[model samples]
Target: MFFAVFLHVLAFAFLVVGRTLAPRNVPLLRRAVGDNSTSSGIASLALDKSSGSYYTVLKAGDSYFRVALDTGSSDLWLISSACTSSQCSKVPKYPLAYKSSTFQAVNNNQTEFSASYGDGTGVSGFVAREMVTVANITLKDQAVGVIDSSNVTLDSDVSGLLGLGFPRLSSMSESVTNSSPFFSQLAQQGKLEYPLFGLSLNRFDNGSLTLGAVDASVVRDVNQISWHPVVEFSPFGMESQESSYLQWVTPLAGFGTNGTTLSPNPSYPEITNNASLALLDVGLNGIYGPYSDVSRLFEAMDGARLVDSEGGLWAVPCDTKQNMTFTFGEQTIVLQPSDYFLGRTSGSPNLCISWPAAQSPSADGVDWHIGTPFLRTVYSVYSYGINNVEAPVIGFYPVTNSTTAQADEENLSSILTTVKFTPPNSLLATPTDTILPYTFNASVAAPTTGLVSTGLATSTYSPIFQAWTTVRSAIPTIAPSYAVFTDSSGAVVTSTPSIAAVTLGSPPGWTGPNGAGRSSPAPIVVTVAILFAALGQWIFCFIV
Candidate 1:
């Protein structure tokens, strides 16, 4: 009995490695990576393809601006051939009439930076600290905003707006002493390996921007990362003086239009039915609320309709083949009626403008805003930790194969609006290639921006600013952040492997996006006695 067949094959190989060991929740980024340390940064991907919007190239000293990467606003500003704002040749200016030696003027006389946007668009620049490179990370001085003047509709591929929110919402000259975005000056000069930053986008534009690491190839399921918790509306937001963590805000948990549940007008205590509180805005490409919760989410989408079109904009209906879910902290995320439909108006192909409406609503306590059509379907994380016991965190990892704008809803081309920023497409990833860590005194390559397909959006009506559109519908479709599932050495498994990770209440439909999930792990039966390991190992191999 060959020792009872090797004790039943070593007890079924330790119960199949303890039942295929699926236990995780690892996101303190592995005890903050030390004993060696590792983090990375190397952005690539730019697509305006007619206003589906998505940008980031940034060079600064030798010309290469495109910028537009907003995590919900902060401040970076470009457009400055000393701004003669004829809307400045459609945008991307800053050559400062030939690199005035990479402009350094931070303040021989500061106080003009007055910028503004949520789409109302405004810019009045003058705040330079320069040097700025990206890819190999180089800040030198940083604080840039030279604009001089503007009307901000943005095109020419896109030439301004980098602001990754918080530095006290830095408005450059909001009275000085404030200003440090661009990853908080790359984590106050230490240059991130731990401060965090990683956005992936796809279906709206190409993707990949990983400063300080997170792009282990755009995570297929870093175990199910969907963390969310960067809240701060402190005494009504912009927390002046002793705490303004400034916006990246979150708290949406509801808003489902094809599977039911669109309720939230309980007389509007700021939309309290499962508690509202949105504003995930990747620098607004639309999706705003409070016109009575976007008019009951377009009347729950059945041949949807909503027109009024003046400045408060709303014209939804170029043919809505409906699909939009969005509920967080139990996770929901789904968007694909061509991701929010923002086109066909100028000559009206029967109309089609549904970004959700807001660039014109007053009583600014904020009602809703989750833009970039739900950030091209997820994989967005933002961190700023290094203190406060490692605070600041926000994640959502669903996008698995998102080649970015996945053929824009079936081979669609572009040409819808402006704010264009063109000039970088070899398929993208240039700074002289090699995702950079440094080495490009001048091979020049950062211009990439050719995908512009969002044509027809020239509106102007102000009888107290109004707007809308509508038609066609459908619903109930999610639970597929694109799926790929890997682990037994195939490498790629993301958030959702937990022994502890479920931070507090989450799990009604998705234990994903990034917090991974809190608990439920109660299954480990392993009862391998096998006749006490084959008669006590054959009486210890015949009593020794």
Candidate 2:
């Protein structure tokens, strides 16, 4: 009896110590399956071959909705059943709020949200609070926009967009005081073990969006990631009293081909000595840069020529072997010919459309929009800082090494048909003609290049021009959008926008900014306490 009583006293003492030692923000225990395996925190993503977009499932209330994961914007919007836009007919729509048991209207459904994108698409809807779930993390009373009208054209597979950008970019910021985005809510509620998330995007297989943790399956080494500070400045060309953190913008230290670094266009002298800023946008299918810079890049490749200046399309010889390189900080990422080359042009089998297209300078003064072509080759991690104590950073882990890229390029070359046609030097000049007309049949089989093929017969313009128009038109623009708000009474509402991680040079450990350790000891202490209590109960029974 005395021994049993002693055990109970010890158990009680342990429980008290455990409670006192527990962290104020206790992290969820890591799954036992693997350190980085898909737990409730990882959402699998499907790539749309046609549009080059990646989407994942978002659980809002009781319904499962397929939404694109867009880092370029900061609004969670879904097409409502009441939407009558022609574009809405092409995609899925969310059921009415009445259908959801957990749905609560924000401001009695008087708050309205509207946004316009760079792709000439826009959405206007009412804001509401709903229980939203992504992967395993659940955000109760999360702000969601139910679109009553929209012109956004999305892949048939996806119904909406889940913006993973900063809250300052949110369209509903003025309407809802608690307008934090889905990911932001996770941080605010201490759902993340770490304040960062990692993306592992695959070209052939389904990728994953890992929340609060890095995906270890794709990352060979933690040391592979080179971290860079996120650009914190006023939106390029916008006048503001103070600088603000906007998109996931980072510096592009250098760009080159075949070990030869290319100089920035002399016209944009700002980027001459300084590194050009690039927005790491997953929503964009291809890489876009200033016209002069893009022109210079293609000009370096053999038999390459500008096809459509307005659409920013270029034709390169199918047999070209030029390798592209991009530098971020001290790390350099290389893309072999197969990685950046699109499929062959229809009728003009000797030439192919390059994945790096041209675009005017972005409103944010960003020089480059690095999209799937660049992202697919690396594992990306975006750190929002731990409890707002650290500065934000973007880390890139090279998934494709030099040897792997070489093998893939060789395989691609083996499957491609050889061509002997030489492109005219005159075609390299940017065309000032009206946008050329081109059409693509949706039912054609994708070439071995894993890209859509053109079905051009013949046209007045060059065969390259005809093929490029269709290909360029198929690629959508996914830059950050402008926000506009309205009231439930259909009156326009105007408001001023209020402006709102990780350790560098450290190996692949749990250390974050300021050497804040990510490892948690609370679980260990709690487990010990539970075991002691269980043992004490057993001892008491044995004594009895």
Question: What are the RMSD figures for all models against the true structure?
Answer: 26.9, 24.7
lDDT of 2 by residue, 398-478 (tens): 876773235343455543433222334465456422222211221222121111111111111112112112222211111
For each candidate in turn, the TM-score is 0.27, 0.68
Give the top-scoring candidate (lDDT): 2
lDDT of 1 by residue, 435-524 (tens): 112211112221111111111011110111011110001100111112235546675433222222222212223333321323422422
lDDT (CA) per prediction: 0.48, 0.57
User: Would you give me the overall lDDT of model 2?
Assistant: 0.57
> What count of clashes does model 2 give?
2
* Candidate 2 residue spans exceeding 4 A from truth: 1-40, 235-240, 265-273, 386-388, 403-425, 431-544
Roughly what TM-score does model 2 have, to 2 decimal places? Answer: 0.68
